[model samples]
Target: MISIRLNGTEEQFPDGSTLAEVVQHITSATQGIAVAVDAQVIRRTEWASTALRPGAQVDVLTAVQGG
Candidate 1:
């Protein structure tokens, strides 16, 4: 298993996991969300090709509606 920091919390997953897997594991709704790895923004189209490394810092932000 590999360790990664997700939204400021340490989490573990099997090796060779992609960004898409993590995103799916975190939430079911994929819309209105942004993902970053090691402080770099990852485009939605590249999520499936992006792989996570041990100790990687992942940040996921969701859009909110406000006036």
Candidate 2:
């Protein structure tokens, strides 16, 4: 198992889980969501290739319609 900090909370995931998997596991929504690792925004195209590391900070953000 691998440990990661997701959105200020600590969570565990299977080893070799990609960013896309993490995002998919957390939320079911497909669009208007963004992910960042260690304060860097990762493009959608890179999610599949990006792998989570131990102690890495991961943040998931959802967009709101009303301002």
Candidate 3:
């Protein structure tokens, strides 16, 4: 397992995990949220290809619907 700090919290996951797998651990309501790894915003199209490393910091942000 690889250890990572996600949004200020420490967590662990299997090695060679992708951004998509991280998203799955988030709340169901965050399905449409955006993710940034180590300060770089990850495009939606790249989620499947983005591989996270140990000690990486992942920030998951959600879009707020407002007028």
Candidate 4:
């Protein structure tokens, strides 16, 4: 198990989990989502290959349309 900071909150996941897995757990929407790890933005194509390390700072943001 490993602990990571998710959007300012501490969260846990199994060891060796990828960023894609965490993103899936956070939302079902496939578009308008942005993810950053340790303040670095990660591309969608790289999410599956990006591994989450313990005590990592992860931030997830979703875009919203408003008038």
Please name the candidate that would achieve the greatest TM-score relative to the true structure: 1
TM-score of each: 0.92, 0.90, 0.83, 0.91
Give a tens-digit lDDT track for model 4, residues 1-67: 9999989999999999999999898889778999999999999999999999899999989867878
Q: Candidate 3 residues 5-65, lDDT tens each?
A: 8878999999999987887786555467888899999997798898999999998888788
Candidate 2 or 4, higher TM-score?
A: 4
In model 1, which runs have C-alpha deviations exceeding 4 angstroms? 65-67
lDDT of 4: 0.93
**Against the correct fold, how does model 3 do in TM-score?**
0.83
RMSD, every candidate, angstroms:
1.3, 1.2, 2.4, 1.5
Clashes of 1: 0
lDDT of 2 by residue, 1-22 (tens): 9999999899999999999999
Question: Which pairs in model 2 have colliding backbones?
Answer: none
Report the C-alpha displacement of residue 10, candidate 4, in angstroms: 0.5
Cα deviation in Å at residue 52, candidate 2?
Answer: 0.8
Alpha-carbon local distance difference test for all models: 0.94, 0.91, 0.86, 0.93
Best by lDDT: 1
Candidate 2's TM-score reads 0.90
